[model samples]
Target: MRIYLPTTLALLAEQHAAGAVLVPDGAVVAEDDSEDAEYAALMTAADASAVQLAGAGRRVVVVADLAAEPAVGAAVPWREVVAVHADVEDRPAGADPDEDLAWFATQEVPDLF
Candidate 1:
């Protein structure tokens, strides 16, 4: 199953360099549909990363296809879901419920590493 893994840019770079996505804890997945729920899970992951690493650098949501299932400890969405690495810039300025998932410049991504 695919999962949305929220992480900092630095960590992402490290993982990229290492050539793997270890499927860390707190990664989220859609308990229902594949399209919308994945989007919602992605947003949730992005929002969570933002909160955890505010001002550290650009946040990243690593969409990965995991072989095994991790513990699911959150509420239900059952919303449609998909796989995509959403940046802070993907979110519009002053958007709805998840404003924290707003976008940031990709240029700064290098510096974060």
Candidate 2:
């Protein structure tokens, strides 16, 4: 099962800390017609590409800002696409780090097969 993590650098770092393997190093382009048209175009292209790739039994996991845009939960014929919301404040400073680490150690990311 291949996991696709489309997120920002900061969140990618957090995912790494959480032991998410094979996380692609990239940013999730936000859609904006006026301020970020280029980014929007890039996102559209990425989404289309993902849709195609998903058909080949690859698991696509989109990690985006949930508050910004909720990922479309549509039915796909040959793939399992899961979206995980990136929580900026899920980890607090000066907190018991091991406690938070324990959660991810037992958490299931999902199985594509």
- lDDT by residue for model 1 (88-110), tens: 44333333535434333433334
Residue pairs that clash (backbone atoms under 3 angstroms), model 2:
none
C-alpha lDDT of candidate 1 relative to the true structure: 0.56
Candidate 1, residue 34: Cα displacement in angstroms equals 3.0
Q: In model 2, what lDDT does residue 113 have?
A: 14
Specify the highest-TM-score model's number.
1
TM-score of each: 0.61, 0.25
- Largest lDDT belongs to which candidate? 1
Q: Write model 2 residue lDDT over 1-110, tens digit each, in one string.
A: 22224433343345545554232433344444354563453444344333434333221234322223223332122222234322223333333322211111112333
Error of 2 at 90 (Å): 33
Where model 1 places Cα greater than 4 Å from the true spot, the runs are 71-84, 88-113
